[model samples]
Target: MKKEYMAFLCIVAFLCIAALLLTGCARTPEADIVTRKNTEALTDKAAGGTENRKSLAENRKQTPEHYSWKYNNDAETLQISADADILLPECEAVPMYRLSSGGFTQEQVTGLYDYLFQGRETYRVEEGGLTKSECEKQIVRLRKQLEELEQQEQGDGQGDDDWFPDDEREYLQGILDERLAMYGDLPEVSQDKKIAVDSTLMEQTGIDEREDGRTYEETTHSLECQTDEGDSLYVESGSVDTSEFSLLSYQRPGRYTYSSGIAVPVDPGNADEKKSENLPCTYQDARALADGAVQAAGITAEITQVELLEGLAENGEDGVSSERSGMYSAFQFQYTRTFEGISVATTASEYVNEEEFSLMWPYEKLRIVVSEVGIQEMEWEAPVSVVETVEKDVPVLSFADAAAVFEELTPLSYEGKIEKLSQGETDASMDIHVDAVRLELMRVKNDGSKREGLYVPAWVFYGTESSTVYTSDSGSAEETWSETEPTPWIVLAVNAVDGTVIDQVEGY
Candidate 1:
């Protein structure tokens, strides 16, 4: 009886414990809703992770770690793949001649003389007292008109015989003559020495024919001259086309047509003779040639440094290229206009493989293409010196601050097919490498006029902005996959300066 009672109590305790467990296991409606919400949140997270697989590198601003930000140190350079397929049509480069005794043609002399003189004409306008003189003349004419009107009224009744009124007519005519005598004539400036030298040049003019059928008539002309005040000015130019060959083709946007690839705006004529002999001369020789041209033209600019374009790089190159078997045919010289040994800022000067210029092309320049023989040709801007120049303060932006400007995202666009890089990147959007930073002096003209410019200091930077183009497309905005590299189009001179951009082509 005692054992049965103990078993019943144990059974009751077990049943109560089981009942408590069942109560704990049971779920309310709120609990079930919370579980469902947690599961949906996890599903949303997974969907977001699946949506964003590929990311764009350009979305973030990039700064170069490899380049020195100082000009005195190593500068960064970029390899720019040129769309050589495009060429400038109807564009002719000025031919450079060996500074000979022969002088400029009559037309050349007259044109330059008039050009500079015309520039000074405005200067004399204010000084000549012409405005006051005109006012006095206008008053005198008014008096004469009134006198004539009174005489006509008096003669209205009289016949033709009395119409003259000789005494009144004579008095009025005398007054008019006196007024005319008071008016001073406009001023004229003469540089007799320059004109005398020009006459000598004209006497020595001649024409020569190249081995090719082309004939380049070279006549010495003063590209620059000086006045009594010692200001350097371009007062003369020659009627000469000293190039050894004629242009066979031209390249531009959309299409490029050339007679021969060799004529690729490189050395136009054949250079068979120099191929055997040590082809390339020294940089010293190149510098001498440039100085000679400047001296011949009477320009005041002195080239401080003459750097050779690298065969493979932009900043600097490994020793000199092989003279005979190099990619270039001649020594190209770039002259950045200077004043008193200080460098002047030029906008459209790209002196690389060859000197070229164009309003249509983004970065055009005036360059001299020289060979072993001498200066082959020149392409330059018609730059004129200011009669008066003003100085401005240096830019407020610091070097590092200017560098930080690149950290901001900017849009880059390109035309035509691009080069294919081993690393797959669409060069359509460009990434620039900050190579060299410089705080240098530069000049900008006022009111878009080539004359009366201002000299100011700016932080100039040089670098390569790279880009890639696509031959085809794949994937949507959210998801993308590409196994093959896309075509790339890139142009450097992501220039490359500071201060106000006065013109389209801004370079240091």
Candidate 2:
């Protein structure tokens, strides 16, 4: 009895341990199923948490490895086949959604596609590249699908009638019309040719010329006969009936016409001779020729210097014994010509008689002199000791005659300025400061009045202040003063007769 009881207890302990082990294995599988469901739910949430979520196993089975994300370096190209299911990051969705390659941006591709597929029945893809055409074809197919979807949506009362704006639809319709017009069938060529030239020629040439000639009974013929072994003879003849030789039936032979003249040879030697005769010659030809011929030559010319005498001897107001000295006076000039050449030097004076001074050459150096009283009174004159002489070529004419020729070549008008003017107050001291007024020559007019134009030389004192401040009854007066300290003055050139200011020089 005791032994049976011990075996039963051991059996009960083994059953208990087996039951606990079974319960533990069942709980582990339930926990594993719950954890797997939670993980799947988390993965779906990561993939946008939509009903269209595809697991990794499903994605691997549906899409090929080549259709997955790939990076390319060579050719700088990125290609995505139709089978591709690329999923970009949310941040890159906008920029990375389009494909680009071969200098064609995504915008251009989209524009081309939009032009191809989004319009009316008039629109059709005439011809295009493989990729663009394929894209257009896909868009057309998608549009058909969209139409079916729209039908279903309308049936379900979910149709979106605002899919395309009015402006966009009109633009697309216009584009379709333009494309259809551009690709319309070509027109057929007309077969008239005024109608047919060949047919007309055949109709004109249908009659035989020989038959036509035979109708007139005037067909000319030639025949020849010869013996078996003897010399042969030949004869030729032609005949025409008077009825067949109508004036309207005769035709004139064509003649060729050409230009009426032939090209003549040019005589270059004659042309050169003509050109040489027409060439211009210089005025100094005689002088150039004589320069080589003459062995020696001398020249003599004279220049006059006029000055205001400051102090000179003069008769007093009493006109007799009440004499005075150092008074202003005038003087006379004496000229002498000197002959200097390879031969000798001879002096001659204008005051001498022609017969006495005949030995002296016509062209000789001349000296001038003035009275001592005049020299002392002249403002510009110093003590008269000696004068510098200038040599010039002597023409075959006299000095006065040459001067006349020069005057004919040069203008003979003088221009002066009314430099200073002083208002004369009654009994007011009239000790006016005299300034050196400059003068210049200007163009002459029809009227006898002179026109004075002035230009002051660079770096010269124009005038004193007292000379510039004077008021006078001139027509128009202008004064220019320098801006620097101790300003220089410039008085404009004015007409003395009419008092018109002709030209002015601005002070620097």
Work out the TM-score per prediction. 0.35, 0.11
lDDT of 1: 0.33
Q: Model 2 TM-score?
A: 0.11
Q: Report every candidate's CA lDDT.
A: 0.33, 0.22
Q: Candidate 2 residues 1-508, lDDT tens each? A: 3453344335434543455475655332111111101212222233242222232233324332222122222322111112222221112111100000111122322332222222212211223323433344444654555556556655754445665434454655565454444433422332221211110001011221332344223332222222222211121222112111111000111111111011111222332222212112221331222221111112221221111112222345322322322222222121221122111111111122133211111212222112221111101100011111111111111112212221221111100111112234111111111122222111111111111111111101122222123333356564432221111122122221111222211100
RMSD of 1: 30.3
- Given candidate 2, what's the lDDT at residue 38? 22
TM-score of 1: 0.35
- lDDT at position 138, candidate 2: 48
Clashes of 1: 14
Off by over 4 Å in 2: 1-335, 340-508
